[model samples]
Every structure is written in structure tokens, then in C-alpha cells.
Target: MKNLLVILFSQALVNNFMLARILGTCPFIGVSQQVETATGMSLAVVFVMTMASAISWLVQHLILNPLNMGYLQTVAFILVIAALVQLIEMLLKKNSPGLYKALGIYLPLITTNCAVLGVAIVNIGAGYSFVESAVSGAAGGLGWGLAIIVFAAIRERQQLAPIPKAMQGFPLALVTTGLLAMAFLGFSGFNVAKFVGM
Candidate 1:
């Protein structure tokens, strides 16, 4: 249990997909204009990442490794991720039209999001068990969402703050992201593996 908590915290903070791994930047910038949209995207990402990690783990252990087909890992993982994104898209379209529309192209673009694929590949590389992979995937998504939402809040306020014309838009957001990433770097010295007894 302590190990699981450590994994979750490590992924969600110390090794955030956004601040640390630097994945899924497209939607991080696109859908993060509003907190509501960011929340919805984050929930969807958490669900998909968790499920994809589990399924990919099963496929790797059960099929790929057994048949000596390890070379197909990337293709196999992307296929799984693409299918999951499509499924989520349909479900969202039917259950929540407003969110579906708000998400727009970004929802479908999740198929290519490096964070999703990165989690699946990282799970396999780390040799994490099924439960750990799921936890890590969800945590990574949570971290990505946390970073984007917080950055969105900052941008929201920045809209009103009198700022230099040169750094009004993307330039300012980029600088803020760099600073936030540096702040997250402070967690690097805290050894998650030591706490988890790994």
C-alpha cells in the first residue's frame, strides 16, 4: 500500500508527464483555456491511460513476449491507444455532447498524444505489475492535468494583468511553463523508491 501511494505521488508530482516528461503539450495548451475543459480532458485522459496501460501490459506479456515479437511494441501500443481514444470519443459524444464539442479536435488528437503511449511503454520498460501500471498511468494523467489546470489559472489571471506586449500570449505561457517546470524540479531530490522500499 505504501509503495502504491509512493508510485502515485511520484508520477503525479515528481515525474509529472507534463512538467517532467513533457508529453501531451498540444492539448495542454489548446484545451487549457478553461478549468472546466481541462477537468473534463483530464478525467478522460486518466481513464484512457489507466485502461490502455493495463491492456498493453496484457498484450505484451501474453502475446508479444511469448511470440518473440517485441519489435512491434510501438505499433501495438499505438493501435491500442487509438482504439481506446475512439471508444472514448463515441462514449463522450453520446453521453456529453457539450464536452464532446468543447473538446473538438483535441479529443481525437489524443490518439497521438505521447503521454498515453509513453505511459504504456514506460510501464513495460519498468516491469511494473498490472496494478502498478494502472496506478502509474492514472497518476501520470493526473499530473498532466494538474500542471495544465494550474497553468490555465495563471493564464486566466494573466489576461487582466498588465504585461509587456512582447510576452502577452504564447511567449508568456512558455516562460511560465519553464518556471513551473523548474519548480517541479525541486522534488527530484526526494527519493520515491526509497520511501516505497523498492
Candidate 2:
């Protein structure tokens, strides 16, 4: 339990895919104009990333490694993540039309989100077990969700704040994101692995 919690905390905060590694910025910026939409996207990401990581781990250990087809890791992971994104898309459209409409093209863009693929690859590289991969994936998604929601909330408020015209839109967002990244960088000194007994 402690190990799992440490992994969750480290992945979700210390090494966030969005604020720390800077992956999946497109969807982060596009769908983060509102908290509600960001929440929906985050939930979808959580599902896709978790399932992709678990399935990809199985594929690597059981199929690819066994058949000496390790060269196809990227392609195999892409297929798995793409399939998961498609499933999420259909389910969202069926159950939450409003959110589906709000997410718009960004929902489909999740298929190409590097963060999803990165998590799978990282899990393999780290030699994490199946459960750890799943947890890392979920934590990565949650980290992304946390960043996007916070960014969106700030942008929403910034629209009402008095600011120079030059730094009003994307510029302000860029600066804010940079600062957010800097803040996350502070976690790099925390020695998460040591804390987790790894």
C-alpha cells in the first residue's frame, strides 16, 4: 500500500506528464478553457491511460517479448492507445453529449497524445509490474487533469482581470504555464524514489 501510494504521488505530482515533462500540450491547452470540459477530458484520459498501460504491459511481456518482436513496441502501444481513445469517444458521445460537444476535436486528439504512449513506454523501461503500470498511467492522467483544471481556472479569472492586450490570450497562458512548470520542477529535488524505498 505504501509503495502504491508513493508511486501515485510521484507520478501525479513530482513527474507530471503535462507540467513536468510537457507532453500532451495540445489537448491541455485546447480543452482547458473551462473547468467542466477539462474535468470531462481528464476522466476520459484516466480511463484510456489506465487501460492502455495495463494492456500494453501484458502485450510486451506475453506477446512481444516471447516472439522476439520487441521492435514493434511503439506500433503496438499506439494501436492499444488508439483503440482505447476510440472507445472513450463513443462512450462519451453516447452518455454525455454536452461534454462531447464541448471537447470537440480535442477528444479525438487524445488518440495521438504522446503522454499516453509515453506512460506505456516508461512503464516498460522502468520494469514496473502490471499493477504499477496501471497505477502510473492513472496517476499520470490525474496529474494532467490537475494541471489543466488549475490552468483553466486561472485563465477564466484572467479574462476578467485587467491586463495588457499583448499578454491577454495565448501569451498569458504561455507565461502561466511556464510558471506552473517551474513550480512542478521543485519536486525534482524531493527524492521520490528514496522516499518510496525503491
Candidate 3:
């Protein structure tokens, strides 16, 4: 239990997919203009990532390894992720047309979000068990959501603050993101395994 908690925290903070690993920057920057949109995108990513990790883990162990088709891991993972994004898109379109429209291209872009694939690959590379992969996926997603939402909040606030002409818009955002990433780097020294008595 302690180990699981440590894994969750490590993924969500110490090794965040967005702020730490820097996997899914497109959506992190493009869809983070508003907190509501960021929240929705985060939820979608969380759902898809968790499901993808579990399914990919199963496929890796049950089919790929047995068939000696490890080379197909990337293609197989992309297929699974793309399918999951489509399903989420349909559900969102049916239930929340507003959010669907707000998300626009970024919603579909989740299919290609490197963070999703990165987590799946990381799970496999780390030799994590089924439950560990799922937890890591969920934690990674949460980390992404947390970073984007916080960034959005900061950007929202920045709207009111006076800024130099040269640092307006994307320039300012990039600087802020860099600073935030540096801040997150502080967690690198944390040792989750030792904390959890591993």
C-alpha cells in the first residue's frame, strides 16, 4: 500500500509527464487557455491513459511477447490509444457538446499525445505489474492535468498584469512554463522507494 502511494506521488509530482518528462506539450500549451477546458481535457486524458496502459500491458504480455512481436509495440499502442480517443470523443460529443466544441482539434490530438504513449512504454520498460501500470498512468494524467490547470490559472492571472511588449502572449507563457518546469525539478531529489520502505 505504501509502495503504491509512493508510486502515485512519484508519478504525479516527482516525475510528472508534462512538467518533468515533457511528453505532451502540444495539448499542454494549446488547450490550457482556460481552466474549464483544461479540466475537461485532463479528465479525458486520465481516462484514456489509464485504460491504454492496462490494455497495452495485457497486449504486451499476452500477445506480443508470446508471438515474439515486440517490435510492433509502438504500432499496437498507437492503435489502442487512437481507439480510446475516438470513443471518448463520441461520448463527449453526445453528452457535452459545448466541451466537445471547445476542445476542437486538441481533443483528437490526444491520440498522438506522446505522454500517453510514453507512460505505456515507461510502464513496460520499468517492468511494472498490471496494477502498477494503471496507477502510473492515472498518476501521470493527474500530473499533466495539475500542471496545465495551474498554468492556465497563472495565464489567466497574467491577462490582468501589465507585461512588456516583447514578452506578450506565447513568449510570456513559455517563460512561465520554463520557470514552472524548473520548480518541479526540485522534486528530483526525492527518493520514493526509500520513503516507502522498499
> Could you tell me every candidate's TM-score relative to the true structure?
0.94, 0.95, 0.97
* Cα lDDT, all candidates: 0.90, 0.91, 0.94
Model 3 agreement with the true structure over 1-198: per-residue lDDT tens digits: 886788798999999999888899999999888999999999999999999999999999999999999999999999999999999999999999999999999999999999999999999999999999999999999998899999999999998999999999889989999999998899899888887788
Ranking by TM-score: 3, 2, 1
Model 1 lDDT, residue 29, Cα: 84
Query: How many clashing pairs does model 3 include?
Result: 0
lDDT of 2 by residue, 1-198 (tens): 767788798889999999988999999888878889989999988888899999999999999999999999999999999899889888988999999999999998998999999989999999999999999999999998899989889888888899999887788989999998998889878877678677
TM-score of decoy 3: 0.97
Q: Model 1 off-target regions past 4 Å?
A: 193-198
- In model 1, the worst 10-residue window by lDDT is 189-198
Best by TM-score: 3
